[model samples]
Target: MLTSGRKGLEASARGTTVLLAALVLASCASGEPEAKIEHLCNVADASEEEALLRGILRADDYTTDINNRTSRVVEGLERNLRDIGPAKETLSTSMCAYKPTPRAGSDRARFEFGWVPRTSKDAEPLLSGGGRFDANGAFGESNYFQTRLFVRCDMPGDLAEPSKAAWLYARASYSFNIGRTDIDQAAKDRQTALAYLMARRVTDALGCENKPLEKPPVVKPAPTP
Candidate 1:
């Protein structure tokens, strides 16, 4: 009887050991799926933006430098607005220049990446919601890079009317065009990527609360009192 009992106990211990080993193996296999490069490329507006900017950076040494500076600025903006969500608009009574009506919601934050304006020796505003960068001027004469990125914010009461639609209106000189073939195809590829990324980023940035601003005061402000 003693011998039989000892044998049974030994078998039980061995079974327990096997079970534990299996559990360990299962745990080792259990981990978050690795991020897909394509998915990552598509996820953050920043990635798309960066890919586009990097194209210009990869264009030529000069363009690369400009892109690098722009990248830094975008990084800073992303950090600042990481938690801010979409803005809502309301109409104000002002008639001369319309104002956005205010609506409130949870902040919607996203990442963006792009080249700085081609004219900016350093960061400076080129438009109310944009900046200028000179990739060649900042980087060098190689002309490999040329592009910019702008992180746009849609504040409450912004885009109060159809006139406020987001659009890319380029006023190019007659000479201005997509680069000539003599330019590196690779660099041109980057430009294409940058354009797509910029488009995507802008579209993403246009998101706003559907609700219009609280009704604007119909009466004009009493003749500037």
Candidate 2:
């Protein structure tokens, strides 16, 4: 009887330890920190040369440079949104352009630029009802843009289609309807249109479609020093 009681007591102790461990694990899991998010859009088939050329073509009085313009717009939009959490993010572009000149000996040049997105690649996005949540605990909506432009330029031997450049620009702009329900629909519609227009304006000005070579998937900008 004494031995049996000891065994029973040991089993009870083991069970208590296991239960405590399980509760600790559950608490730790619940208190885990939120992860950052990575949002990306590609404007492929554009090279640095192509982007430079586009910038030259688009500049009217040399007042605003292409890189500055692109960065400004992107930063402005990003600021409009609230910070989701504390995490490093990258927002970049794969952009190219062509600039035309009337001067002899020099015809055109290409330029490119890129930036880190506000979201990080390793961000662990939050979920609601088993679905991924927006920056706010809401669903997000977005749109895309892709088109072509025609330009005359010499072809590099490595890439195909040296006679025409294909401009593929994709912008994924999203908005979450968290607080204001009354104007949610109208605001979303407006944001969508604005994103498309902004993308088109830059692409068209760059003359990205006028190149004779294909571009990579993402617009790569030279690392800022």
Candidate 1 runs further than 4 Å off: 1-40, 43-78, 82-143, 155-193, 196-225
What lDDT would each prediction earn against the true structure?
A: 0.28, 0.30
Q: What lDDT does model 2 reach?
A: 0.30
lDDT of 2 by residue, 1-225 (tens): 011122333556677677777777876799954432121122222433224323323322111113344445444323322222333332434332222322223322222222222233322222221112121111223221111111132223322242222112233322222232343333333433333333444444334343322332222111222
lDDT of 1 at 186: 47
**True lDDT of residue 103, candidate 2:** 28
Highest lDDT: give the candidate number: 2
C-alpha root-mean-square deviation, each candidate: 22.5, 26.8
